[model samples]
Target: INIIIQNQTMIAQMPHAADLNDVMSAIEAMRIQEESSYQCPDYLSKSEEDGSALPVNEECRRKMAEWCYQVVDYCKFSRETVAIAMSLIDRYLASNQGREALANRKLFQLAAMTSLYSAVKVHEPEAMEPKTIAGLSRGAYNEDQVTAMELEVLGAIGWRMNPPTPLAFVHHCLALLPDGSMSMSDREAILEIAKFQTELAVHDYSFVHIDASKIALAAV
Candidate 1:
């Protein structure tokens, strides 16, 4: 209930819808730039021979994703933080060919913590300290281990931390909705629900293969 109330307050305090046009334009520019600069590596469905095999199978992947959802919620991090962390984990796993090195549960936990730490640094103003993040792991990792994993993740992804996420596309589309198409109260309600749906979609591995724009549209 507190979470819902907090979300409502945040949404109410968001900039006026008119500013969405500028946000949309900026996101579109980012999309173009990202496409030109980096190609999203095949991570989930790639053949084993491609050196991009999923370290965990489908069932394990689902469990890992659920764990991520719980951790993010417990920490009260923004939804965007979870999305960014998930992206980092996916990209790192996809690009690296060594499945044996990451097959252990401890290493995966470290990766998740490091990814969350990195995402928090980028997206949150009051960043979560390395120790706090380590504590969340129940001593599976220490502060030094978390910091080390952070550097490893950064190197693995080539320092590309700002990849476009579904929430970005969703915001862009919501901004494009026709003005006065609905009552102000109705619009706010729809936006809240759509945003909720988008957050849920992020945790579902099935949606990982879908395009961000498509997911955003479906959510809205």
Candidate 2:
């Protein structure tokens, strides 16, 4: 059964920025959540209700995480690319109830497809083709299902074609580093580090409130 959201109040306008107090609260929350003791809620945690469907289980989560990093390493995606992919997954999970349809694996396929789509749009717009996305979905899900998920993702994000992403912060931090004095190898190393840290941050919901800029800076 779908969880009923009660007394939902809709906001008409989006805030462009946070005030100083809001920023301090967000920073403190992030710090508190950064502790090693923190554990992520299982994507597939089951409810006590008799008919409730579980989200992705631990095994699936592990496999999904593995596949995500594989895509990053294989594609040689920049830190920003990895971050955008992750943001896509997190956003979908937050807003979509695909998990409730656990009799099938559509939601799992949706997650993978959306992550790939988001990454491509951000890092390699030239490389991303409609056919490519469709093909990826065709491999694991019905073309119609994938199309629906894509639409769902787009709508949930409010059709914002250019969302600010972690890579934006990563770039800003890199500029503050040595003036191109760093070796190519060092830069690549930083890229890998930033990407890994961004994925690790996904486990903490508090990380969501922290700007990607700070994460990139602290990672450096």
Residue runs of model 2 more than 4 Å from their true location after superposition: 1-53, 57-62, 72-79, 96-105, 129-138, 177-192, 202-210
C-alpha lDDT of candidate 1 relative to the true structure: 0.66
- Residue 84, candidate 2: Cα error in Å is 0.8
TM-score per model over all chains: 0.79, 0.56
What's the lDDT for residue 98 in model 1? 24
Q: What residue pairs are clashing in model 1?
A: none
Q: lDDT of all predictions, in order shown?
A: 0.66, 0.51
Alpha-carbon RMSD of each model: 5.8, 10.4
Candidate 1 displacement at residue 11 in angstroms: 12
lDDT of 2 by residue, 1-220 (tens): 0112232221111222335454445445444533311212233332324455655544454465566666656766443455455555545554445444343456665655666665555455234444555665557655555556666765654543233444444544454454467886887698678756766764344565466556666766
**For candidate 2, which ten residues in a row score worst on lDDT?**
7-16
Residue 183 in model 1: shift from native, Å?
A: 1.6
